[model samples]
Target: MAQPTLGIMTLYLSEHSGVEERSYFRKVIAQAEKLGLRAVVFTPVDVDAKNKRIHAYVYDTETGRWSRSWTPFPHLIYDRCRYQDSERFRKFRRFRATYTRLVYLNRPISNKWGMHQFLATSARIRPHLPHTRVYSEHADLTAFMRGRRLVYLKPINGTGGRGILRIERQSGGHYLVQGRDRNRRIVAPKLVSAKQLPLQLAAWNVKDRYLIQQGIPSKLPDGRVHDFRLLIQKNGSGEWEVTGCAGRVGPKMSITSNLHGGGQAVPMTELLRRRFASEEKIEEIRKAVYSLGYAVATEVEGRFGRLCELGIDIAIDPDGHPWLLELNPKPAREVFARIGEKETYEKAISRPLEYALWLYKQHYGTSSSRRRSGAGKSAASSTR
Candidate 1:
């Protein structure tokens, strides 16, 4: 029998190309090989919708290169595309509409403003969410920043901590604007009023398409602010689980604890232990971290249907309260590799493949047992 085909979909940047090479693809191929599945790579543009065929791309491990081949439409699609308002995404959506029964592993959530509005409906999630308002007229900023010690001006569509400004209301009745440069260096400037906000945001190349969020103090005693990147993914049985977590501590004066800004990734337990003297306090933090991570994933999945994974960023205030910063649909797992968490790092790579397979079986009534499944047990089976 032909193996079940699972396709990984990414947006193509080139018209002439159907496949792009990535280090993670190699890992996916290896994992799929053991699970009796053929892993195919493709872009939406590469699909011959009229013919119901795809110019599928596959990797040659022996030759260390990618080769294009023709294949039938995949049994299932794992959507990892970074969606945009462009025609490409729109066309893909139209093409996807033809397959009414095709299983989409996870629907993409790309709009920051939309996601915030949906998650806000959950009372459990609301406490952790920072007070946020859309940036529009000068009065919006003026009203939101009033009586706040610090506020963050973030791009509504920003990711990886890009295009963010930490505005502090100074005691002298002036505004302190601080942001990060492309080089990860701090770009601190002083602004006199809301009118100057545009001058500070001129570099961002945006106009009022931003959010003003209350800033929680996340710095520790050593003057370093840290963020916990908690990764959540679905297992073979189709359940949300917290795979692993690590603390990303930013440079001494950096606005965000983003790894893109040369931040250090440390084990979460180690950082919490050293920061908290009381074992009870540390245990409380541990519980809070896991609970919040699960809550965010489940809450979002309920509000926004069919999410296979989530990257939840939790920041701890000085008093030990965990604040949910933001949730990412596509999260980078390389930080675990840098931290030497081998088990967690390996599971991060394999869970998506396992979940993809499980989704096929669930909808198609295809049975795959552990004994017949050579893919072995999932990473979720291991203790973190």
Candidate 2:
């Protein structure tokens, strides 16, 4: 019998810039091989629906190397392509529409606003979300800021905490606008009022295609703003499970806790203990975060589709309340590495492979065949 194959797809893969990411694919390839599955790495350009084949770099476990070859599309696909290029995105759509039968671990959710709207359908997940609204008119911005002291204006399709602005209401009824500039440096605070908001916002030249969300005051003992990044993945049983989590402390005077924004990783439990005096309250908040993370993973997929994993960002307010900041389909494993949690990082890397194996067996009926074959036949086949 031919060994089952698993395909990992990304965008414009090259050995030069793919140095860090290639190590991850190699690890998954090795682990998948252990489960009697072959793995290959490819890009959208490598796919050829016209010929029913993909020219991919297949990982050979025998010699531990990658070699390019043409083969049929694997039964399972792990879509990691961000579709940064508009043209590449159109190609992905054509391929996906044709290969509708191939199993996908996680379907990419591009627009943050779209994901929020889907998640808002569930009452259970709605409260955990910060109040969010589309930004069109300056009137809406002023009205939202009127109720909350601080609100964030974020791009609808932004990632890595880029293009985010923190608008805060200051004393004497003035407003302060500060954020990371396009050059990735912290911008100077600008003062404005309700009357000046329109002109000031127009000066920035980006009031369209964004969202205004109420900001939660999640601060450390040292007064640095931070948020939690909790990793959740599906297990071998195909159930949602919390894999790993860490505290992302933002840079001084910055708005986001993104690693790209000069943020540092720290122990989440220790941070909670330092922020909250009572040990019992700290434990309570920890449990809540995990529960909320699991809920997000499940509810998001319930609305969207099957997701192999998610990185859920959470904010803990001063009152010990946890809010869902955002959920990431492509959660970076580096955060766990920074926090010195090697075990959790390895687990985070391994769970997707395990889930893929589970999906393979479920879709192919391998488990049931073994069950019906009994122990003797199963052992006999394994040795063969």
Candidate 3:
């Protein structure tokens, strides 16, 4: 007799041997195994030096134990891999072989034309977005800059406050443009406008793709520009739900409120009460966030249907209107740690685990099959 099988995919695991990082993956893997399922982590590259295996260890939640096992090919995947390194990409293709179902949540979607196409046609989404334009030529960017008082130049595929620029009109023909360089350095904001932009762009630019977005007049409460991060997850019932929501306050005038950009995280309920006096205004924001999440989940699942989770970055204007900043298919859990709250941080990890479990059940079928057949557990479970 054979036990039921489960396949698990993890986008990242620690390369180092420290307890800090290793403990996190261990906990997630163990929880899956405890819930009567096999768990394996798929990595872009093998972390251990002794063997070239992509899957590492299986954690026993009941016993609170971990040991080397034959890597269980995952039934479902949890994508946490931020970016692909050379070594990781080589391993990614190999890992794709074993699993058919993936809770991709965020598979790397880098194609600009495809993204633009998806967003443009998504009737549920188009209205919530700010005016956006993609351009490879300098002429288009210059023209757009001249027309709009404020614009943001963003690398179409970039993430984590990387390679993003905010341009603001300054005195006379001068403009203040702040953006990140290729190496993730903050090049001091340059004073340039349409007149100086061409020369400066030609000299300093490294990205092959860029988008000039009309800057939404983001509201500042207590002198910090703020945005909302809604964490949407799929439950066992197979419906999308808002697991958590937080407000990010950019460290005064920083174009991006990304946690990496010296921003502070506040509870969304706190911001709504403190910043807006009207209940109607707050309700509108709540409605927009909820609507946007559903639309994005639907649209994203339509395009990258395998993905199961999303970290949606949404912004609000002075009038309390909502706009889409970007949808993170591969949003990290580390941001919640910045909030310095234990309960919020725990939900960040646990919600994803719940989604992982939901995906597992969908792919591998019911656990009772294992018990009814008198099978101890699948060899695949031990392998994980």
lDDT winner between candidates 1 and 2:
2
Let me know the TM-score candidate 2 reaches against the reference structure: 0.88
TM-scores vs. true structure, each candidate: 0.87, 0.88, 0.79
Runs with alpha carbons beyond 4 Å of true place in candidate 2 = 13-20, 59-66, 83-85, 181-184, 193-195, 366-384
Q: By lDDT, who's the top model here?
A: 2
The backbone clash count of each candidate, in order, is 0, 0, 9
Candidate 3 lDDT, 1-384, residue by residue in tens: 223333334444345232223466665565555555456554545443355334455566668776656554444456555544445544665655433344343355644445766787878788877787786777776677776778888877657777777778887878787766655566677787667777777676734577878898775656556788888766544567776778887776566777876778887867777768888888878887888888887667656554556788888777777788887776655656666666666666666666655544444555685354333444322111
Error of 3 at 103 (Å): 7.6
Model 3: per-residue Cα lDDT at residue 110? 42
* Residue 68 miss distance in model 3 (angstroms): 5.3
Error of 3 at 59 (Å): 5.7
Candidate 1: regions farther than 4 A off: 13-21, 84-100, 181-195, 202-206, 366-384
Query: Of the candidates shown, which would achieve the greatest TM-score relative to the real structure?
Result: 2
lDDT of 1 at 315: 85
Name the better of 1 and 3 by TM-score.
1
Off by over 4 Å in 3: 1-27, 30-38, 47-69, 85-87, 90-113, 182-184, 219-223, 334-344, 366-384
lDDT of each: 0.77, 0.79, 0.64
